[model samples]
Target: MPYKPQSEPGKTAYQPDVQITRLGEKIGDPVVPADFPHHILRFRNDRWDQSIGLHSLNDEEWLSHFGKFEPLADNLYPPLALRYHGHQFRQYNPEIGDGRGFLFAQMRDHEKRLMDLGTKGSGTTPWSRTGDGRLTLKGAVREILATEMLEALGVNTSKTFSVVETGEELSRGDEPSPTRSAVMTRLNHGHIRIGTFQRIAYEKNEALMLQLVEYCLEQYYGGVQTDDPAAELFAKVAQEVAKLAGAYMTAGFVHGVLNTDNINITGESFDYGPWRFTPYWEPGFTAAYFDHEGLYCFARQPEALHWNLAQLASALRLIADSEPLVAALEGFPKAYGTAFTQHFCWRLGVESRGFDEDRDLVVAAEKGLAEKTIQIDRFFFDWGRAENLAGLDENYAAFSEFSTLIADRERSRQPVSSYWQQSGPCSMHIEEVESIWDAIADDDNWKILSKKINDIRAMGIALRIG
Candidate 1:
């Protein structure tokens, strides 16, 4: 059986009631499943999270979420309309929009946080460029797992709402010869990106730019007023980005590609591509196989973020001074440092005064383990067993079977070590290391460590722990 695409995207003849809203357009309609080629999971009548617990709806019943159930009903969409611009892969292409993605609507979660309902791989749009604008089944599977894994690791990221596999085929050069696509329903506060601002900046569209700044103030920076919106907006965006920079470094995850377009204007991790969790710290390590220059390498993320922030500042120059913008960038390292240190303490299960020598011992032990090629996840999982890890030397032998998938020579190393201590200063104190090890030796600590790893897997991402 061959693949066939929808005759017309966003237009459901069978369910004419399912509304359609274009990106940047005043939110028009809710996205109904049956209206597209998606397979429904139906609502679980007894569930805690309404949007998350939804089972695919029957074809006849799917129109309810889209405001199509009743005529002239107000569509359940996000209140804040977004405006942004950016270059893709360093190329100045200003024609991009939500493309195949859209904000289905916004809703309050069980925790009362305002979240938006977004659709990925919905279909082709005015901004589809020269591409077929379809998402593949692999993407749905990957996104589901990414959401689960990242959340378990305590990384701030978007949540997966639903994965609708449109039984449609689309062509893409990035796929395996011919391609099949899928769509993901994601929940997030904003789908805006740093590139969005860059786009307006490149075009020198100050009018559109200020419109975007006001929108940002109302949606994300509600605490800040918009009287002199440009300077304030730039400062706020810089701060958010700085905070996010720290979050990424602490999580041991590398986004691989940090292009302005992939960078969320809301300062959150948006599109996940060529991303990998660092099992060990190698400043030069990169998640993308194609990124030979190491521009967005593990160690360079902090710097990469600064560069992106500078671009944002340049965009906001229409109304702000460069000095304040640069000053705002200074806060990132400190903020990110504090956040990372706090998270590091929790992961290590240690409650000690900041800056102890025992931290050095932990660093040394990690280096020794890495020298033996210990798997990053496994080493940490079995850190308590440092005195008893029998197969630490051969833990990663299993990965050799998948060698064809990874190009790094060290990928063949067995029992990869943890990157946790690689960046520690040379003058580490012995007491700090012992304290960390003492904490690791406790069975209670091991339990938490084991649970974190399992939780990561259950959420959908497979972590390679030695």
Candidate 2:
């Protein structure tokens, strides 16, 4: 019998929307999935899968689709090697595109929002500039940890959908050679990046650029209701990206590579690599070691994101007027300020007052944190559970204003989970991540990684993070 999913009453059946190819063949090249030596199903995310019902699929079926790259019932027949040029480390690189990953499938989420199932380390493609298209098992593990911790902290991110260890040993410079290898699939809003527009703009195809802008509006920003849809879409994207950036700050996350290609048009954080959570609010702290300039450090993320938005606006200028796009770019600071206040308050388990008052509270917290060498996550976790800065008598005076600011503010309706009290905090510091990966490399032990995911999910559920 064909695999059939019974839909819940009044809910739509799980359907695949093959919309990417509709953008025309010029957008991407059809490619085949690599024939891997092994198809070991490692991880599967069944959250928000009410309609797709992945939790019901057995191991063999999971491997068939995600591992063997077999098509879902009515999804894409052949995956697409998406084409886009990016500014790698602020240097324009037109020669690079989806070197390893490809768009595997497209579907709608429970909220009727369009979602994509994309891959990394699935195979080589036309865009594989000069490398074997493979993701290290360690890289896959790190991404799982990064996405899990980010999601638990309420940052909008790509879900690490599945990981399958290919029976292949690969050599690499960054880490140990002859290490294990794996392929990962992520469920995200879309694979469309700021670089996507850069590519179209580079070709000087104004008509195609206009078409691409409209297509993005239709697919992602359908709520942009202004008569000038192009500029409004830019503004919408600006606000979303701003929210994401501030969320990263409040979450103590440093997205090591904030390049054009790494930035999603939807403003959701994805393509995690060399990401880290700060032990404290050190503005100059960097994530990627190669980022010698500290270009995408903790404090510079807003700047980096704003710069990327400028690039997007520059590309949009090929189709839309420059004035409105510039105006949209100008909204970044205000958007980021508003977002930081809200996210900071939410993380501390307090309700936000007006923007200025809320921002003042955040400033106080950061100012105190700056003086002390404390982990930001601990402060957040402690505040969430106890609703007071009870410990750290030595640092009490400096940080007490944080308590004062929230004295008049009521707590949020969301209850802090007991997990916050039990588990210290779920942080993906490089040391801890390496420890987990070490266990896998040395002993092939996955229990730690599995428990960490559960613990992160438990924290998310405990906080009722929506």
Among these predicted structures, which one has the highest TM-score? 2
Worst 10 residues of 2 by lDDT: 1-10
Candidate 2: residue 244 Cα off by (Å): 0.7
Candidate 1: residue 136 lDDT (0-100): 64
Local error of candidate 2 at 98, Å? 0.6
Best by lDDT: 2
- Tens-place lDDT digits, model 1, residues 1-466: 1111111112111111122232344222223222455454311122213533233454344433421212212434332223345655455566666666655655444443345666677655556677655676555545554555555454567766555445666665554534444566666766667777776677776776777777667666774575678778777777667656755654567887787777766666766656766666456778788888888887788788878877777877865677777777777676555545444433333332333332443344444445546544444444322323334356544333222222211211123334322332111122432333244333314343234334444322111222
Alpha-carbon runs more than 4 Å astray in model 1: 1-48, 51-73, 76-83, 174-179, 203-208, 225-228, 352-372, 383-454, 457-466
State, as a TM-score between 0 and 1, how close model 1 is to the true structure.
Answer: 0.67
Which regions of candidate 2 are displaced past 4 Å? 1-12, 390-392, 414-416
lDDT of each: 0.52, 0.83
TM-score of each: 0.67, 0.95
What's the CA error at residue 110 for candidate 2, in Å?
Answer: 0.6
The Cα RMSD in angstroms, rounded to one decimal, for candidate 2 relative to the true structure is 4.9
RMSD of each: 14.1, 4.9
